[model samples]
Target: MGFADTIPARLGNLSFRISLDMSNNSFHGYLPKEMSHLRQLKLDLSRNLLIGQILSALSNCSRLESLDLSYNQFSGYIPKQGIGNLTMLKKLYHIYLTWNNFSGAILASISNCSKLAAISLGHNKFSGQIPNSIISLCHNKFSGQISNSIGNLRCLAVIDLSANNLTSEFSSSELGLFTSPNRLHIFKNCGLKGNIPDSIGNLSNLVILGLGDNSWTGSIPTTIAEINLSSSFLRGPLAPEMGELKDLESLDLSNNQFSGKILSSIWRLESLDHLSLANNSLQESISDNL
Candidate 1:
């Protein structure tokens, strides 16, 4: 059997608690209201069988800095009182709520956590545009245009919205907004169109970029390499700048409308171990250089 509803009442007396990790257990029933009395710093109740709405009274845990309630049977919208109202959460750094049945819009109030660095609400039924305060938003059923406000997250390092309904083209300035070192951006199958902005090269620490199965047009940006634009509508000649990615190991541009000759400079990518240009309009000529 899972933990009983009376469990919280037993643990409530320890008001000086800083961390409670009851993850991957059979703890069931609603989260207890008695949790509000403790000044916790971290709470992890993931991978459990717990259900019911997150109690608004939890806002009283003023020293909380990390919360992970992922992989559970929790239902209902996130507390309307807003987790942002917890002033102590201003120091919160991570929030994970993946693989749940939670619904409703991601509140703009989440930005109140000025020190927030990572947030994952993916694999949920969340709707509405991503808030500007978010550093990384991914894999939710979110809709609406990805606003340029995303650029405001100077501390952002990764963003993967791989299976959503976000649309719109990024202008040069918009693409250049991301300055995080070692960033990975994925937007596969998201109905995105328009050419990839050349400003993509501006991401000095980018390692992986996936934009496949979209309606993007235009030539592959010369400044970009080590990317996957396969199964899209990208056309035009391969750019010589393909040689720029010294660390590029894999490049996939197959099933597109690329024409003309392949860039010979691509062969010089020392780190490149896998390359694909299949099903394109390129004229074949035997090349003695392998």
Candidate 2:
């Protein structure tokens, strides 16, 4: 009786009215089947050692909203049908599954949770080009290209898909017979491969771009220097004229096949904090002023 093995019986009525905090306990084994009985529970069992499939019985808790089972050892695809039915909890918002082994394409069941302000599935094993609607976070293990439809995320601001296998197109051929302008759009650390798209310059309001760590071959977009296109697969020496973007922060064109002069344009990055032009073929008059 001294062990916290099950949901405390005295709190059943209040389960629907308050958030459950059973996190950071020694609880193990499959969640007891009776968890489905709490009709109003918004449970949080993160940071434990819970495992097994997210049970389908969760659908029975019709009045339930906001479930967090993150930071556990749970694996397998999120149950699709059961979670899709929780249509009434318009206030349900946060889902944090970081630091777990949960796998598969995200449950399209998430669309039912449309009011969700954030979904954190970082440090896990999700694959394929992420579906853009859900606004995924990729780092160090996933791969694939950022779908251009991602430009449609009008409210998106903070996307960190760094340190993985992300690749994308830079420029088609030249700026002459092209579609739009040359704006390099690279969401890194996914298996996205190929050259950078020249059309990216059309995204005139872009900030915090990352196209590093992939197989993209082309010249850096000149317009990109005027903007803030940093940490990407930029080839050739950075134009001496690049020190133009007044709002640049992190420029990491490292670990690729870029060659040419180390532009003092780097010094123009008045707001630059992290600059890594390492492991590229750069040769020119070095400026100590930068």
Candidate 3:
């Protein structure tokens, strides 16, 4: 087997205009602090075997627009002086650092990066309440209620906070505040309770909704298209109004307490491709037309 190699410190001497992409490699060792010298617009070192904390010197790369260091073994708290200092890069927009061993509270200073449109920090060990300024954060150790401040992001379109330690009830008022969103996934047992809010109908652009594997009670909201609500405590008859979702493609309601015969209108969904209603009390026989 070939031995792993380290990034050369000499690379820092290269022209500041050179963008570097060293992803999906077997390179192992600490990221050389010398790399901070280059003022590239994009830097990608994801899917590697690198270790150690990110250098605070990276903050010096004033022209950086995109940075990706995901799928590495890098551990320790993200240097406040390192990432937080990037707010000066007025053009910086995207930052991806998922699937690392990063732990600690997400820096509050990140709120200053107002130009940032997307930052994926999922599958890490991050804790504490999510910063209101962030757009996407998932599969971490975060704990606290879904902040109402999230409603202020009127231009926001996508949000996935699944698989965290959030222990709050679903708030209808909070859901109603969002005016623009097409995808929302907050599932995989995040300790959420209460009914699926009727206010969910306010999201006219919503096409994909995943609220499964939580502690949800009450009936499913009838104003959705694609949906997943399996493994919850929801009961009662499947609403016949579900037939109104003519664009529905997938629906999963397994492992619930729903009882009653399957509605005949469900069989007429011309766009339906996937459907799962297993492990429920439904007494309907399969329709011959299906």
RMSD of each: 2.8, 5.9, 2.4
lDDT of each: 0.75, 0.58, 0.79
Off by over 4 Å in 1: 1-8, 84-88, 180-182, 219-225, 285-290
Stretches of candidate 2 off by over 4 Å are: 1-12, 37-42, 61-65, 84-91, 126-132, 137-186, 198-207, 218-233
lDDT tens string, model 2, 1-290?
12356444454445355568788886677776567667776788887777787777767676666678878887877676455344544455666677778777765445455455455677778766565444446543555555554444444444556555655543444322223222333355534456655554445555545655555555444344323234445566565535765666666666665676666667666777777766777776665755
Cα displacement (angstroms), candidate 1, residue 275, comes to 2.5
* Least accurate 10 contiguous residues by lDDT in model 1: 1-10
Each prediction's total of clashing residue pairs, residues at least 3 apart in sequence or on different chains, is 0, 23, 0
Ranking by TM-score: 3, 1, 2
**CA error at residue 226 for candidate 3, angstroms:** 2.0
In model 3, the Cα lDDT at residue 75 comes to 89
TM-score for all models, in order of appearance:
0.88, 0.70, 0.90
Residue-wise C-alpha lDDT for candidate 3, range 1-290, written one tens digit per residue: 23358888888888465668888888789988888888765888888898999888888877778899999998889888887665766667778898999999988777676667667888889999888755557888888887766666555566778888887776677675565554553445578888878778777778778888888986666666789998878899988777777888999999999899888888899988999999999996685756
Candidate ranking under lDDT, highest first, comes to: 3, 1, 2
Candidate 2 has its poorest 10 consecutive residues by lDDT at 174-183
